[model samples]
Target chain A: MAKKNAWWLWAAAILTYLFLYLPLVIVVVFSFNDSRLNAEWVGFTLDWYRKLFHNEKMLTAAGNSLMIGVVSSLASTVLGTLAGIALHKYKLRFLPFLVLTPIAIPELLMGVSLVIFFVIVNQLLGILELGLITIILSHIAFCVGFVAIVVRARMQGMDESLVEAARDLGATPFQAFRLVTLPVIMPGIIAGALMAFTLSIDDFVITFFTAGVGAATLPLEIYSMIKIAVTPEVNAVSSLLMLLTLVLIVIASRVSPSALRANG
Target chain B: MTLQQRIGKWVLSWPPLVYMVLFFLVPTLIMVVAAFRYPGDYGGLAPMYSVEDGKVVWDLTLENFQRLTEDALYFDLFIKSAGYALATTLACILMAYPLAWLIARSPKRYRDLMLLLVILPFWSNFLIRIYAWMIILGPQSAFTRAVNWLVTGLGFEPIQLLFTPFAVIVGMVYVHLPFMVLPLYANLEKHDMALLDAAQDLGANAWQRFWRVTWPLSLPGVFAGSALVFIPALGMFAIPDILGGTDSIMIGNLIKQQILDTRDWPFGSVLSIMLTGGVLLIAALGAAVARGGRKRG
Candidate 1:
């Protein structure tokens, strides 16, 4: 009876894993199918990839996504690292609430609120239009929480004695931080930066509200395409994006495994 | 605190503090105020004050909130969204339990790898995940054809699978299963094997040991996972928009239309505030229950 129960558990677990992976596998497999329709598995071909390269809109959107990702990640990394250290070191009341609330709220709420806020600000000050700049700012607003979470977890696991000893050995605060603390958390910072970049590139809902016109990221572009019709080109681009994410995860795990766990 | 220590604290905390206030807190406050303000003739909010007959007149009303109560359509939509979220959470629990338990019971060396496998798909682009479902549930896909064939063989009319509530629910579960699995795995990994052993020694069967021990012990994990899944699933617009038909609109879709299509910012803000209130109430209730459970335990 026990053996039978174990077998049932194993079978259920395996089926769940299949449910998770089967859709993704079909997507990848269908990306290379020669037929335009996604129903049947046709002979293998890379025409969709070729068409994607030639498509001006997709390329421009990809460029925009990369540019926005770089700027947002860099800006959020600095602020998030500072917030992380402060959260771990000090007993501040309001900072944690401000930093973490964005992570807890629904993205739609944030997106719509930002849209209202941007319009009001534009009306009052005659600045801050809804474009790439607004989208980047929104990305940073959300990404900071995730980066701070990873960095704070790293700070929690650090040896406090090392920083204290450096201070006691006639090192100034700046010197101790620069020499001791910074090096120790370097992996966490790098991991946080990568995570921020991935998030910025992949953000859709917030970007949808904030991106008024003339600025289309990869996700916004993909959404328009999906809305119009299904095509193998979508599968082609998705496969490539999955490849990019897998590579980033590999590097992040190599740099700091705990960062992944902290996110989970 | 010393002056230097105070200055150090200021240096580290002030940047994020000011940024979050400007970007996050202020925007949320503005949305709250927007809910009461009049909609602009064009798209945005109307002017707060207008000079009428040499006097300042404030243009604010409770019409948006009134609109919500005036019609049962919005109320029905909210209930439908909540129902979908609840169903998604329940389905996630059924699927996540065995997988989470399997990972927890695996040998220590393989646990990390197993957990990573579960999270890997989630890290992919969100739209891509939804699109994957579009393929699987598409009318032309083999899965749909197979279902239709079975239906016809049973003497029932063939049915549409794509762009239905079922498709929307499947997408929600696929997207959120990891949220359930992770917390449950974290909780189950810490269970004491000796308790199970003791139950067995006392003539308890495997089913009894699980029902009497594991189920009760994992309630906190269940609650945590449910909250994580329920809140996001409730607010999800993309899945329903892409996979659901015209009749399957949720509150998120309605909110999107009021803001983007109709240019009714005031009404959009009202809907958003309601959603935000619902989320907060749920969070507070969950926290209270967890605390109450802890006291009793």
Candidate 2:
């Protein structure tokens, strides 16, 4: 009887998701449609696709975002995983919780302070370019915390004996980690890396302050578009961006085989 | 130390530690120092670490604090930001509660799909998502036209849903609804159905059962959701800027204006510092409330 009553519950859940995603669905559908207005059911067309293909700035921004997201995620994942492993392995003064608190640091403070640092550092270094290097470094700063926490959670349940077994088998310390430890924790690492990638791709506040004009990201371009008219072209681009994100998220949640099965 | 442990200690800790100290901690300390130092002290916002005329010339003074006390404009801005944040959080809760309950009660196979929808928008740029609201709310926009059509069809006046405090709240609620829902779902999924059943057995009605059992258990989720919504909502400038359309200033806007437009770093620092403190205070209060409820339980 209670199970039967869950019909109303099903209706509600279905409607809620529809409300959340229907706009995005509309945008995506219209990206392929001939009409300018999403309110109408326009005939399907690839002019928007053709138009999207011809836009050099948009393509360039996409390339830049991919490059930035990859580099930043790689940096943060390496640093954060190292940090997480260190926190668990070493007897640090504070617990993993304290080390993990930058996740809670208000984004505004972090954004503003990092902006100030880049200015000072750029002034001091003189040769420092504000495009790729600064943007990646700043993203790593924001991302390292979340990655550390996620990896640390994975490390908690992991058996300590895995590494010990490798050592007894005559593997060097690095080899043991490569053979025994890395494979076991690679899922957490990949998950953290993916999260870092998405975050970097979505990041604006920190990048806004740190990134130079030449390195203006898709988010920055979108920010300007909004301030302006936010035309149909931006809508088209947003739909594509959303699609890219969904594909990646679906891939990420599948939790690839390389995670547990990869060579440590 | 064991060779394995030695490598772990240095390899894992030092890189992250040094990066955080150099980038995050040092910069935060500098901003803190910047806040305390008086106006016109840092050689006109340039680097000048020197002494002048027998008075230790440093960029550290009480002028910013003094200005803040006299600054009624800023005082009003802070108040409005807090007021808007409170309203937005309440709106998010009102929308999230039933949605979360329904989702929690749904079939297991469908739950993940529904949850993924909520997170999909979140994965999009926060700014662009807010900008979507702007496009919808702009004059002659699809959302506006729909409202007009609905109102005329229903024989009623067109509702004023855009470019006001109402629009801002609506946008904020839309943007932040998932934060409220996710935490609530996390709690609701774990909630014991038997508690409500026991209440029903005790002759309590549905409302009474909810008040006594369901409400009490779900409080941790509610607190977490409210805190999540409220703290960031208070600091939001972008949403209010785009959706509020005009004459809707928040603390974040004020801070941005102070830094970028007004060039009053000391005053901006003070406001930013106040915002940081506000977040901390609310977080502390949330923890205390949760703690108190547990104690009473």
Candidate 3:
């Protein structure tokens, strides 16, 4: 009777997992197809990959994406580490809700709000137009939220006695952190950085409004190309993007439990 | 507790706080300022700031808020967006519950693997994945034609699925399902089977056992997952853009058009503020639910 009842549950599980993977499979299969038809399998070829190298525009966008990912991730990492330490250790009572608001707001509104602010800044400060500064700043705002949450969780789960013990043993606070606490939570920090890096790379909407005409990232380029080019070349770029996204995800899974916590 | 310790605490928090203050808080505050300008929404206002005007005017009026009520377009957009969010959240709950349960039940070694599988796809650019959906649903595409045949040839109307609100719902569910699953799985894993067994021994059927014990226990996960999906879904512009054709637009899309395409900052700001209110309401509900769950548990 138990096995019979559990059968429906198993069926539901399989369908859910299938829904998650089916789209990815469609993209992967079509990327290799000889034709541009998304669903049909006319044949298989590597022409898209070959076209990827020859496209001058795609290469530049790819470079821009890399820079944004590295720079923003670095910025978010430093800020997140500091904020995480403070918030986790201090437990400021006033902000139990405020701390989480950044995560709750729509990314679209956040992006638009940032754009409006940048426009005002441009009017006042004259140096806030779309470019590296704006993109990095926008990324740091969102990425810091993720990093703080993950790092705070790590810090919370850590043993407080280690810090107390180290202090009693004539270790400076910095020394204790460098020797004991840092190592214990290093994985979370790295995980946070990895998440930030991936987010910076994958972000399109926020990047789109923030990135002006002068500097276009890979996703932006892809957005334009799909609008204009509509060729197999974009698919080539997509395959490469897929690989990069997979790598970042693997790194995220390796370093942090955010994805794990997020998943289950 | 000590002076430097206090100073250090504030000092460490400053970078992020300052960044948010300058970038996030200030800009949002500016949007509040912009919401009242340039004859937007309510249709009777002096131009406050504009590129063409080359000056800033100061005035205070509830015109934008007034316009929000007059504009059926905006009202419909908000309702439709809410409907879509609700439907998508429900869909996510339906799809995520079993997968979450299965993952929770899996052995430790395989559990992480399943989670990684679930999460790895999210790392890919969401835009590209949605772009993939465009092809699948577009005309002359293999799947679309196949679906068409299934409908037309099989005594059923070929439903206009793509570029419809249904597509918007599907896109949201697809995007947010993982967000729902993980939290539920986390909550479910903590549930003890012994409780279920006890319920069964007390003459409860499977349905009764689930409704009485399992359902109540899983409330935290459900709340967490729904909030995760709903809040993000409320502000999503991308899914509607890709899947829904011109007719199917959400509040986020409306705001995007206002600010980016229409170049009307005040009306856009009004819409933005309204959407932010929606977000706040959901947050309040989420907080209340979380607190209630904690108390009950």
> Which candidate should be chosen as best, given TM-score against the real structure?
1
Pick out the ten consecutive residues of candidate 1 chain A with the lowest summed lDDT: A1-10
Candidate 3 docks at the CAPRI level of medium
CAPRI class of candidate 1: medium
Q: Please, what are the lDDT tens digits per residue for candidate 1 over residues B159-195?
A: 9988999999999999999999999998998888888
Q: Compared with the true structure, what per-residue lDDT tens digits does model 3 show for residues B24-102?
A: 7778887887787765453322456345477654566677678888869788889988988999999999888888887
Ranking according to lDDT, highest score first: 1, 3, 2
Tens-place lDDT per residue, model 2, A10-50, is: 56666666656665665566567677654455587777777
Q: Candidate 3: misplaced stretches above 4 Å?
A: A1-5, A93-99, A228-231, A252-264, B39-57
TM-score of every candidate: 0.98, 0.90, 0.92
Q: Indicate which candidate wins on lDDT.
A: 1
Backbone clashes in model 1, listed as residue pairs: none
Tens-digit lDDT track of model 2 for B238-292: 7776777567878887776666566566677778888988888999999999999
For all the predictions, what are the DockQ values?
A: 0.68, 0.42, 0.58
DockQ ranking from best candidate downward? 1, 3, 2
All models: lDDT?
Answer: 0.92, 0.75, 0.79
Chain B TM-score by candidate, in order shown: 0.97, 0.89, 0.90
CA lDDT of A48 in candidate 1? 96
